[model samples]
Target: MNPNPLKILVLFYSQHGSTLNLARQIARGIESVPGCEAVLRTVPKVSAVCEAVESSVPEQGAPYAEADDLKHCAALALGSPTRFGNMAAAMKYFIDGTIPQWLGAELSGKPATVFTSSSSLHGGQESTLLSMMLPLLHHGMIISGIPFSESALGHTQSGGTPYGASHVAGHEGRAALTDEENELAFAQGKRLAELAVKLAA
Candidate 1:
């Protein structure tokens, strides 16, 4: 194994864990690539009231993301639980705070991908994926997505899309990812990792 592996950031926000599940699978795919590592991070929740402040460390799951995380990552995978037809406000708020990276073009030429989880089958997974891509695009990242060649993309009954990998969490919003969803997510990450390694080299 290479002592210094390329770091692929898997950054996301999840309220009920479905998005987190996707992140885990993506990490698996990233690490499956030799000389690459998955660096998982997450953003804190947003509050309408101005007084709210999240602790420097998260209570559970991945560590909260920092500007330095962006600075060092070779590539990125952004995930969120869908809010209406967009990413969660917490994830949006975090992206908004990434002005330094955008200004410096720190993410330029890197391969990036997006993923999401939604409360229902029609709950805007594709739109959510697209929304996340906007910031990455502005940062000059090359967007990578799951293709029809992945097979799961062609036959998935629930929650896989060419735009990105996604999960249908049902109305109550906590369902596990179906087999197809998991497979596609894994493929998405693997594809992105391969691309990122090639680009970084």
Candidate 2:
């Protein structure tokens, strides 16, 4: 184990609890690594109409992620709910605020992974995941993805992809994460933490 626990910031936006559940599973997987710790954070919602004021801290669940979280993290795992084949606006807004970190190269050379949940199987899980990766790539972080050999990818009738971990919450947007989806999410997190350790060395 490393002397300092590898901290992987699990930042995500969950509107219907599906993405939030996935984030918890991923955090569990990260902490499973011998020298890794999971820092769970969530972003506040934004209004589409005009200025939507959110408290500095959220009313419930993890506080709004801070720019400093990116600075100190050994790795990152980002998650978001689907929004018309893309990540939600709130998550995008949060990422957009990381310009300072990007300019300072604070996240450069870090390992990162993305996860998403959709209302339907074809609701653009892959697209949402790719969209989330773009900002991390601009920050110069290496993108990590789940391998097909995970078996869950091959067996998941609900949601699993080689691109990254995902869940099909169905049109009803349920809370239950299928067994295969949960396994894949955990696997992805574990892989990210392991890579962070190796990179830190």
Candidate 3:
């Protein structure tokens, strides 16, 4: 691998914190791998009002992600709450601004993964994960997903997918992640980090 520790960016957009929880679990998995460091970052919400602007730094939780984070990350784990079978507007808006990186192939050949949260079991978690992958694919990222070998993937009643890690946040979007969801999220993170190390080497 590179002499320095690998920086794995854990980037997400959460409206009610379920997605953030998944991001944290994924980060834990990333850090479990020696020489891999999890760098947590978030994107600001987009406003319908033309003049509304978010502060540079988030009020709490992870700081806002910058283009440089994408440029420098050895790998990425992207998460967002499901928005009508797709990624949230905030995440999409942030990704829409990554044209410069796409042009330069800044994230090309890097390993990446996706995660998401939804309010119900059938709330399109897999589709949300797939939606997030499109932009990363355009950037030439190597997408990674949880495998069926992860036992939780077969048994998770609420949320777990081969596409990636996911959580069923339940009604009101306040449900804590189930044990299976947590395990799968961590596995995805660890798996992504491992791939990053090998690819970088």
lDDT of each: 0.90, 0.90, 0.92
Return the clash pairs for model 2, or none. none
Q: Which predicted model would earn the best lDDT?
A: 3
Model 2, position 169, has a per-residue lDDT of 85
Q: Please give the lDDT score at residue 14 for candidate 1.
A: 85
Q: What is the C-alpha local distance difference test score of candidate 3?
A: 0.92
Model 1 bad stretches (over 4 Å): 48-53
* Candidate 1, number of clashes: 0
| Model 1: per-residue Cα lDDT over 13-132, one tens digit each | 988889999999999988889989999999888886532665778877799898889999999999999889999998998999889888898999999999999878898888889989
- Candidate 3 segments whose C-alpha is farther than 4 A from its true place: 1-3, 48-51
For candidate 2, the lDDT comes to 0.90
Distance from true position, residue 110, model 1, in Å? 0.6
Q: Would you list the rank order by TM-score, best first?
A: 1, 3, 2
